[model samples]
Target: MGNANQRTQLSEHIADILGTRDQPACGTSRLAIRKTIACGSMMMLALNPAQVGAVGLGEVELKSRLGQPLDATVPLTLREGESLPKNCVKPAPQNNSLARLSDLRVTAPARIGPGTYSVRISTTNPLHEPMYELSLMVKCPGATLLVRQYVLMLDLPGMPVE
Candidate 1:
């Protein structure tokens, strides 16, 4: 019975991402999953273009715990010259400083391209979410640039990777 429940839970989680669990997938990132071989709530960035002010600048969908749309930002950390796609939109930025006392909701668009792109999502307290000193690395042809870090709390218990 326990095993069955686990399987059911897993299925539900997969279905939730696939949009069979609740609301249909909406927004560019979710919709583009079919176009790109690699697509999901999380993306890994690799390269960044020069003369770019912000990378991964846009809005992303965040479903409520019940699988409904809840405005949320897909926070990003970029290296110098590493920036998000332009025209991205999201909910107004929240002052995460007061996150402990209340739900600080925010949102940003998911970034797409040939560079490594990723957003931090987790449940740990906001203070531990790396609000500062977070930036993506851009592997240029001859040099690597670090874009300014823009932290957004999306996933619970955030996970870090290179």
Candidate 2:
């Protein structure tokens, strides 16, 4: 009984944070609140995988400057998916030798505590087009969600890589 009450309170707290409460449309507000609660539940579950169930959250897409160290913090409740990898994020093999990715890995906010995580990588050279593929994963129960982002590495003038 107490656990259920606590869960409800937590859901309400998360709903407030997500701005899903007190809307004009009651039906839509309920649905949005429900989704927010589910996301909050996922965050909690991800934080304590051993005690709860799954250990996955969501996905996000990011863009950065070319020839510079890429550091990005993406929210976990960005999208839903089906699979993930052993590591949260990894660099895919690049076909173009002129543009390459190095030192790719997950950095700070290692755990899924704040519904966000950070990734870092160093890109070298310039591509014909401003695009690079980055692989990301989130672990869930019995499955993992895999997301691929075509990061747009913008080429700015007077940049080191340019």
Candidate 3:
């Protein structure tokens, strides 16, 4: 015999992040087993040569995105030098911000399951070609989903790696 219809207090998102460290890159952080990975992404960040900004999937900004009933968007404490990507508004002065890394999205369709994903990013300007890494957003089976942000750097021709 088994309990067929029982709602349990299975898992929560915030608690998971607090307890979690050294997490592999995953858009959706992991949740306890037997819980549904709550749909909808969390804050989307743009990684480029100069700065990392929160990208909006909808009309509202990523950090400001409203949370769902189950999977709440994690409270993001922004560090210094963080701002919205340049294209969100007029191009600022050269020293003000990083050039826009436009059209940032997953390079390939992700197969539904727990694993790493590949995100592809391209720059709006041609001269400032930058380097990037493949970051992952992992999720536990049957767990809520959220987006994890990353930072990338570029090496210009004459720049020293110091």
The most accurate candidate by TM-score is 2
Of candidates 3 and 2, the better by TM-score: 2
Q: What stretches of model 1 exceed 4 Å from their correct place?
A: 1-53, 63-112, 124-162
Ranking by TM-score: 2, 3, 1
lDDT of 2 by residue, 8-88 (tens): 999988767677656568676777777778888999878744421234334433444544455445544322332233354
Against the reference, the lDDT scores of all candidates come to 0.39, 0.50, 0.29
**Winning candidate number (lDDT):** 2
Question: What TM-score does model 2 achieve against the real structure?
Answer: 0.37
Q: Give the TM-score of each candidate.
A: 0.21, 0.37, 0.23
Q: Write down the lDDT that model 1 would get.
A: 0.39
- Evaluated at residue 159, the lDDT of candidate 2 is 60
Candidate 2 Cα misplacement greater than 4 A, ranges? 1-64, 78-89, 92-100, 108-114, 121-129, 139-142, 158-162
* Shift of residue 144 alpha carbon in model 3, Å: 2.0
Taking the tens digit of each residue's C-alpha lDDT, what string does model 3 give over 1-162? 133323222233444544443444552344422123322222222223333333222111121111111111212222344432222212112222443334333233222222211223333323343523222232222222324443334444455545
Model 3 has an lDDT value of 0.29
Clashing pairs in 2: 83-144, 83-145, 83-146, 84-144, 84-145
lDDT of 1 by residue, 1-162 (tens): 999999999998777566445554465456445535454323434332343443432333332222222333344445554545432322233344432312332223344434434343223223333222222233333333333334434344334421
Candidate 3, superposed: residue stretches over 4 Å from native: 1-99, 109-117, 123-142, 158-162
